[model samples]
Each structure stands twice: as C-alpha cells, then as structure tokens.
Target: MSLGKKLKQLRKEYKYSQAVVARDIEVSQQAYSFYENDKKKPTMPVIARLARLYQIPMSELLNAEENTKEQQMEKFIEVLTRRIWAIIDLKYLNNNFFDLCLVIEEQARISLMSVQSREILEKKEFDLDYTTLGKLRGDYLEPFKEEIENKNQDTELIPNLVETIFLKEKEIASKYFE
Candidate 1:
C-alpha cells in the first residue's frame, strides 16, 4: 500500500482523529489530513517522527520494500549520501554536535545494506577483504559507526534532533500534501 493509505489505516486502527495525531506531532489537523490523503510526502524527519509515534521502524513508515542487491545498494547510497550532506549542512549551521551523531546513526543503518550486498556478491562463503568491504561501506559509514558509539549517553540530545528536524520537515511535507 502507499504510505498515505497505510498511515490512514494505522490511524483508524489506533482510533486517532487527524487533529489528535497532528497535535501529538505538533502539526495542524489539515496537515495531518493532507498526509493521509498522500497529497504530500513527509521529509525524512517527519517520517522518522511518524515511525516513532506509530511505534514502528522508519522503513515501515516509508512503506519501503526489500529489494534485490542492486536496488538495495541504490537506496542505501541515496539515504547515506543525503545523510552525509545533512551532516555537512548541520556543521555549517552550527547546529548541536548531536545533530552530526544522529546523521551518523542514520548513515550506519543505511550501511547495513552493504553487508547484505556483500553476501549476495560472494554467493555463500563470503571472503571479502576489510578494505574492499570498507570501500563498499562508503566513506561516511565508518565515521558514523564510530561516532554512534562515541556519542554521549548523558546528553539525550540526539533523539531530540530527530524531533527538531521533523518540525522543520512538517512545513515541507505540508507543501507536498497540498
């Protein structure tokens, strides 16, 4: 099903009105209606928020289907590259350090696709070298992995970055919905 239909089904299943879901996500009722109508696409941030709100994974919220290795790599690169650029933009904006960390986590999740792709390439007894596999992981993947581990647990800032970005994304989502 399309994301909008899925969202509407979930909302109805959960017994939530558009206003209720919108208020929970800090958006207007009309905006939520637009989202349900598939008149607009949510940004990564809003999609993330919806995933959390719906208590599901981001991929599930996006209605993303599993694909063959080639397709997966393409998607992995798309998400990974966008995250890399998001980190650079955050740095330029002087956003919090946790913003970078969150972007890194996002990248790492995308990088998991490489492991799947490698397995497919090897066709059984995977014997890929570290360097070759690392290259396949892409430049940003390692840094993201390292930062995710190194990120401070006390700050509780990274989780908030998703919400902060979502609020901004809601505006863009609204335009698409319209």
Candidate 2:
C-alpha cells in the first residue's frame, strides 16, 4: 500500500468522496486524485491535514509502504483486534469476564468488508466471515487474553502480544489468500 492507496482506503472507510476530501484538505480535486492515483505526493501540510481528517496519527499516514494486500490485511486485522481488546479491557475494568465476552460477541456483528468493498453487499474481494473470525479468536485472541491475564496488565508486554498475534494471524491468513 502506497500512501495514495492508504489515502484512498481511509477516504472510503470514512465514506468521503474524493471531492469531499479535496475540499476538506484544501486541495483541488484533480490534485487529490493525483495523490490517490500515486501520480503525485502530497506536501507535509497536506499530509498533516489528511492525518487530521482521518483522525489518525501523522506517523501512520506518512509511514505507508508498498506491501502486498495480504500483508496489509493481516496488519489491519492485528491492529483492529488489539484495539478491540484494549477497548474491552477498559470497558470491563471491574474484571467481569462474562460481560467482556458478551461485549465481544456483540462486536462480532461487525462486518470486515466495510474496509474492502466498493459497494456494500454487492461486491467483496475479500471478507472476514464468521468461520475465519472464529479461527482468529480461538487461535490468537484467546491465547492473548490468557497471556494478558497472566502478565497482570503490564504495558511492556504489549509488543510481545502484538508480535504473537501478528504471527498467528499471518499463519491463519495464509489460507485466506490461497
């Protein structure tokens, strides 16, 4: 994913048209198109504006790389799942495991294609269906939950947790692309 593709993805995720993004970023529509098409790079100011618009750190926007779609999706899943875990932990700070699982189940209604589809329910190049979701939770999230429980909420353990999740997702996602 180049920065252009990242911009496009963010725009689509936010349901912003190119024109809307152009107006928000104070760039011409053609210039924004060029940026999304990889024909031109945006200046730091433009990048900063885009970062603000996307509500993400500028570092995330600027650090875009040319990775395969599989790698990108794997990374996306890992980041999202970790964020979900963190949210669950915060929301259930009373340490009610039952409530946590209930929240997780409710969140599971989320469809993955919101990030992948050009049109909702009309097209899907890839989707995280329930089967894969089950595998992911069983293979990665459960173990990570156990590990976190054992670690007693040590922040320093996050990197290792992320690495473990990433590796597990990579292994599971291999079947997905094939």
Q: What is the lDDT of candidate 2?
A: 0.61
How close is every model to the real structure, measured as TM-score? Answer: 0.36, 0.48
Clashes in model 1: which pairs?
39-177, 40-176, 40-177
Task: Please write out the lDDT profile of model 2 over residues 1-178, one tens digit for every residue.
Answer: 5788778878866789999999999999999999998999999999999999988888877777744566556645744585557754573444444444444433432313323323432332234453445544554555545544543655454456545644554454444333
Task: Report model 1's TM-score to 2 decimal places.
Answer: 0.36
Q: How far is 48's C-alpha from truth in model 1 (Å)?
A: 1.2
lDDT of each residue in 1-178, candidate 1, tens digit only: 4567667755754678888888887777888788888897877877877888878788777654343345434434544456555665444224344444444444544443332333343553334332233343333333333333443433233344334433332321222111
What is candidate 2's CA lDDT for residue 102? 42
The C-alpha stretches of model 1 lying farther than 4 A from their native spots are: 64-178
